[model samples]
Target: MAGTVAATLLVVVAAYRFRSSRQDRSLPARAALPGNVNQQLSGYTFTRSEGGRRIFTVRAVRTVALKQGGTTELEDVVVDVFGREGDRHDVLRTGLAEYNPQSGNFSSRGSVEIELNADPPPGGSNGRQPAYLETSNVTFRQQGSLVVSDAPVRFRAGPVSGSALGMTYATKDGWVELEKDVRVELQPAAQNVTLAAHDPKSTIPFKATAGPGLEAGVVWLTAQRLRYDKDSREVALRGPVELTQGNRRIVAGRGTVFLDSRNRLTEMLLEDGVHGFETTDNSSMSSAERAALRASPSSEPALAHSTQSGPPAHGTESVPWLPGSEVQRERGPLPEALEASAQRARGIFDPASGQLRKLVAEGGFQADSRRGGGDRKQPSVSRLEAEQFEMTFEGVHSEPRSGVASGNVRLSVNSSATSVAPKAVRGGRPPEAKTARATVKVQPATQTETMTAAEMTFDFRAVGRSLKRAQTVGAGKL
Candidate 1:
């Protein structure tokens, strides 16, 4: 039903447009605009062309310019054109290839140049939006739609801006196609992210077709031969998108990226390609930082499921009863150096709990300490090293909200230290003992006081829409 109504409207509008043939334009090729146009400006049309071959016709309004000794000048502005005419024939509106002194450079070669400049009407009621000259090469065929631009064309809109290497406009479909190489460099504004490019063409995105009455305030970008639905708040790079922040840059094969009003990337979708990894050598981030960088969530930090060794592999086990409540060890006690070193090695921690969302680092899987027989006056500790360590953290919100979070850490490393210090009798000097450096290494020969986790993850409800679960396994030396 909608299609039928649209077809009917097109036919009705097309018919009404051709009702009157006001005049004709016989513009001869010349070096400058013909000084006299009252006799030449009469070609005014309420219609497109007779057959759908003609793209547009100009109706020049006569005026006198204050410049050039105050001479009467002819402003040949093309008010309107038939969109269908160009589409049906694949006609391209292009500019002068090489200047020809004999005739005005365009139309004679089947190329057209359109320019328009009119003052805003009183009370800002002018129907004229802004306009610029369009120039390109075109080849129109009945069976095949017209394609413009055998070469790069340019748009000299004004002194500060220009667009080049444009595309085609089909009168039959009323579609203005922008080429893939199209680039546009906008002047920097208070908040606008400016650009620079070549052979750029643009159109309102197709998403609007899904809406009612097509809301305004849209600048559709077609680049790399892809369409984008963009707005002031966010610029969605629908196809492969890339953003260059100060020290971080993200490029996605396919995803929607959310940026702040300042054009900072907030989050994006990071998918593994055929090889399971995407290589990036961003110019912004330092080598160390780029290597350590992880994928930004589609949202924020949320606790994952209840975890045993780490965040559960891929299930609801990541989420605990409460979220974001973490259990951290109280750093204290011991021989000053031993205590500090033990704090570094870790000996005790609250075990994993389903009720408590926890993130912690474990120094060893097992730690045994024996009380002295009383004959011995000193407390003693033995050090054992393990190759690999595990850490876990989870989110549990009694607040009725939680998500995957960098959880509690459970890590163990190999270490060595002085065995025992001999004590002296009260008021007497103690026996002197020689000391050697204590050395320890974890079990698998892969552990250290500082263990680099393969990955740390949390499970949380994300974007308040669905679940957000993350797990990072092996990354660096642990």
Candidate 2:
């Protein structure tokens, strides 16, 4: 009986083990694959080639492929992008990076550093410095060669360093953009000296020194945003922009900077509610509105033009031409040099040397002058208002050749006092007995001369340090 029982027990135990094995075989598949299948690598490097030439390289201390998602994690990553024929080299390094191979999307887990190097083009500066950038949370699209970061970024290129809230870089097209709150400060290698308007027949005037508030060889620019297109060699600044070069300050709603092939500033366009001012000799100030500044390739430095519409309205606020009692009371201290305003203004410049050649202000233009103010006997202020006004500079020195004001021109001269003879003393003495005592009074008066014509021109000549000759041509009341 005991042997039969033991045999039955052994059979029962075997049956139990077989049943457990069957159950284990029927279990669901594992959620994760083995570690070897994920292909984790150490000191991994990747290269992208085009036309049998390596275009870019990616290196990492360690790379791991996630099992659940086909994403790659890289530690201590470095990426190098090569430009045409390896003339340009750009490097990007980050502590950690995440890459989605299927989508060709890559992003930095933390801050990234980028260095961009470019070879100077033929005939360009030989010592161009590499551009460096530091930013956080960067995303890159490999297929499109686009890199973007919404986080703040800091950049440095030679003497220029700036910070921006956001940025985008397109490697394929060489486009770089700062999305908002862009500020740039530059320390120019050389001072950009420009000659003021002078009399061509006379010797060149002494160079005007910078005022107290102005800095030499420094440029500051602030804007809502900035964009640079390498293909077009153009830079654009969006609204509420301000640019300060030396003592000059320009405020505009929007502006654009055109660059030559060598990345030199060639032209600038300011639009919408544009206002610019510069402190001149003495306490005088020169300011303008609605103007365009351009640099020409010739010997002239730059051309500025401003335009306006409609005729001069009656009793409109006049732009002060010079610093005088009235101008001081109304518009504060005036610029010692020439000051002008108009609806539209245009300036001609010599592109090669950045010299101002000519300036034209049209459409209800006005110019005020206190140039000859030392002589109290002469008018303290002289103002000219017309439909259009122009000043031309000639010769290599950019001397003032002539000026013209046309269309309903009016010239007003304001003196400190006017001599008025007492009314007929002989007859007045006899008649005075009937009316108290005859009173003789002299009061200051403003003499105004108006000229209505299709055109008027003034030829200027310099004598000593003042305007010696001014010849006017027009048929009108003077």
True-structure RMSD, every candidate: 22.5, 13.6
All candidates: TM-score: 0.30, 0.57
Go through the candidates in order and give each one's C-alpha lDDT: 0.30, 0.60
Model 2 lDDT tens row, 192-255? 4333443322222223355432244456778899988765766888967766654345555777
The top-ranked prediction according to TM-score is 2
Scored against the true structure, residue 115 in model 1 reaches a CA lDDT of 30
Give a tens-digit lDDT track for model 1, residues 84-171: 4332111123322221113322221334554322232233422322233355454433333333555454443221133445555443
